[model samples]
Target: MPETVTPLGDGPGSEPGGTPGGTPQPPRGGRGRRTALIAAAVAVVAAVAVVGALGLGGGDGGTGAPPRSGSLVPVTRTTLTERTEVDGELGYGKEIPLPVRATGTVTWLPRPGAAAGRGDTLLRVDDRPVVLLYGALPMYRDLGLTAARPATPAESAPPPAGPGAPAKPSGTAAPRQSAPASPRQSAREVKGMDVLQFETNLAALGHTGFTVDETFTARTAEAVKRWQGSLGLPRTGRVGVGDVIYAGGRIRVGHAGVRVGSAAAENALTYTSTSRKVVVNASAADASWAVRGTAVRVTLPSGTTVKGVVASVGKQATAASEGGGKDGSEQGGAATVPVTVTIGDQRALGRLESGPVTVAYVGREVKDVLAVPVAALVALAEGGHGLETADGAFVAVRTGLFADGKVEVSGRGVREGLRVRIPE
Candidate 1:
């Protein structure tokens, strides 16, 4: 059984041993009131002391201090655009390695930074000049002449002396003109898309007669002979395997890999399209912002700002090595996707070569919306969140999009120019 407890202030109709209630004698009116007043005063004093000890009173300089009042910030309506800046490179876009088809000692090379157009001489191998042509098909076989019967001396001779032909001057023998030696012919006979490339190049160079096709016909041989003759080469009606380099367009030599005496090999030079462009490697997370056709701002090294548009975005991501580690390994690396941006105003770049640049990608936007500092929001004891009014009253609010240190807010009492407190 639990022990019986008695209250400190218990006073009642008395019973034997204070076990039961009975009619109790009443004290003098004045003294009874005095005792009651003194007990009440003591209880009040003890309550104050306990509150102070627990640091729950406003008078305490600790956690018990009065609520702090924060400064007010006015809500405003404006247009907000999410923008991100990333590092980029300004140049002629990606570098394409030029493969050499002919193998020999590098006899001569175009000067660095030179621009070579279709049908222009790009370099020389063993004293044989390799020409640059505009085409996607690579040269795979030697272009040569088809064997044909030699012209008879009578057919080659100037009109046979006819009975009525003008008498030759005395001592002036008819100049003998031997038909040009049969154009040189190659043993390696080939026909494919490479032949079509040759025909296209011949046509582009103003030599036309044969149809542009995969077959190497006698007409193509004749055209080749004409082209060779124009170039002051032996009109052999033949082209060697290393006669031409096929490219997409005019190529600007960015770098040379072979020297005067180096053996000609693949990737003898690196070149790019003449058009300038900007390339940016962006994190995969930001790939969505690099959609093609999106306008952007490019900050050049000279501090010039030019408008540009997204040209292309890579579909795949790749690891990009950043800083070098102590053990000579990649450090702080991340996967990135390539994005190409084309400048709208090409002249603005001036004579700037390849260099570091900055590109800004504009993202989502919110317009004509009421927004407040993100710090203005406060949690309420009653649940949910609210903003403190100028008069220290808490008004509940609902939040929407959050961006740029500001958040969209709405509530019954929220309005434009309404000041809301922000924590310092």
Candidate 2:
């Protein structure tokens, strides 16, 4: 058999005798490259499978290994204050119109920022001072003294003519009894709710000896005389319609509609509280959080921050109209209510008249409580949310206030410095 074996003819790279050139070569380079590509593909598939398993298992590898270092967050003990910021306007509380009942040329007017106290002259019409008085009632009539009258006709008339008196002359009319004049007949007649207001304010102004009632009496006239005398006016014991202006309280002139020499009509001036406050028109839903006495932070236009307290929360909601549809149909808007906030530091407002401001209404507060990023909370199959531990374990937790991207959490194993996992 060995003697019968024959050598095969070689191709291009091999010599015929096949001594030194080369034996038929296999495709080593191509095979090696193909094997490498297959191995690379297998590795990629394995890695993708591992990531898929981790994701499916809720941030935990099926092997029960801890999460990646970047996904761990440590529980912290800190104060978390929940707050909401709302747009507000920095200025006096509310604008109140000061209407002038006296029709005449405006003689004098207070400067826009002038602070007028009760009994202070707000403005002058026809050279008569229109004084400011704190009262809830509007002055509608003059205040003056009225003479007292008999309570009964019998008391007012003389005893029936003596029966013994000669019979009335035939066709002779008995002495005509002049009908008593009505209280309104006198030029000094004074009667109205305005009289009650005048008496109230006079009492507040240190004037005494007057009952605060709707009826004007001699005692009321005395008080009026005292008030008039204090103002350097004649003691006429009377108050004309334009003599006083009623308002909720002392006011700072906000605007003057009528200048000197201008006719004083209904709305002659606008005034507001002298103290600076922030007014927020909050949506009805958000109004509940803006309770009176709630602490707040006010950011002025100049980037200044000041402490404040909610002074009042409006009970009534006001509807705001956005606009009409293209066909002129009405398009309704949100209902909002006003919230008044008073600044604790008035000096910080400086010379700013009115500007847009931001009011952060502080809500629930968690002090020195265990808290974690909201992202760290996980929904457990059992019921409530839980905090995932570093070891792929979830500790049941009771959640409290949520604020500023953090949540107040308490549980068996959730304490400060305990690292929790946040799914990436």
Candidate 3:
């Protein structure tokens, strides 16, 4: 049976002045159950846990050495940590749905996992490409000339040929050739940051002829025409609603929801950032444990450890369901909160796209304290836990943080470097 509290008012037995160590007593009955602050590692935990004198030194009462077989382990002062590890998933962060603003049949789609950069075609609707532009604003209105004005005969006349091309027969009715000013240049123009966004893409695509500003000019329209022609679309100087879409930067296709023959509708595809990230579904009770911006460690599939930080914590809770359809549905599984983690180094993850990973969350920490291998702790005869001195004395100790293979200990008699007996 577990030992009765000896006399160590703080724990079991103790001599005067609060120092543990009264008289040793052999276990009086069968082994009893006791909750131990033991580590979960197989190498650290023993098959059977013994208590009292029989489990420790096996001596009568006061002795200079153990009466039975054992080894001496000294108490050491060190820092201990409380850590909790949970399963995590590796991926390209969350997917953002892309709305198809054009009205046409989906004619083409890039393969999933393909990446699209600024000014690149994300999808082709009715054979017209819906190009991707870099910007925070979405394409909600026409950003170029709304309509082109009718041209006069003089304005319609062509300019003189360049030096490389044959001269227009010495201008023999070259119609007094002269470059006509763009008609829309004098008319009102579309204005806003959206205009600047399109112009930015236009300049990146090498179709620059206009300044990058918030207002779309006739030159901007000309640039748009050139860009459209390169994509095999009609050279309409005006950009239509289905002409393009905008995002922050390069994105990878996550999934294609529209088929080549299907009618194009909203949410035509999904895209995610090009970088790899980690997602963890933590237990709901761990909300406080996984605070935002908390630093953590992740173990990759190759056993390589990488540093990570908690990028975001979700407030909503979700849980898996247990199937019991007809008979009667049962309660759902434990609720969990979603957490996102970011890794700074791309080379560390290598070419891994998605897989399972382990995340370690640091909890409480105890500094500069006396501790010993958890295996050395013994249940007191009366109640509580204590450690055995190498000299065959029982020192009732109050336990603190438990981590690694050691447990923090403190008591009147417990001191650093003090030898404790470990049953072989």
* Cα-based lDDT for every prediction: 0.76, 0.77, 0.78
RMSD vs true structure, all candidates = 15.8, 11.6, 18.9
Whichever of 2 and 3 has more TM-score, that candidate is 3
TM-score of each: 0.57, 0.58, 0.64
lDDT at 117, model 2: 90
Best by TM-score: 3
Tens-place lDDT per residue, model 3, 203-317, is 9889997999998888888888888788887887888877888889999987887788898877788999988889987778656878788999999999998999998988899
lDDT top scorer: 3
Q: Which parts of model 1 have CA positions greater than 4 angstroms off?
A: 1-80, 145-191, 314-332, 367-424
Model 2: lDDT to the true structure: 0.77
lDDT of 1 at 176: 71
Full candidate order by lDDT, most accurate first: 3, 2, 1
Better of 1 and 3 by TM-score: 3
Instruction: Show where candidate 3 strays beyond 4 Å.
Output: 1-63, 66-78, 147-184, 204-209, 229-235, 300-304, 323-332, 375-396, 413-424
Between prediction 1 and prediction 2, the one with superior lDDT is 2
Candidate 1, position 120, lDDT: 88
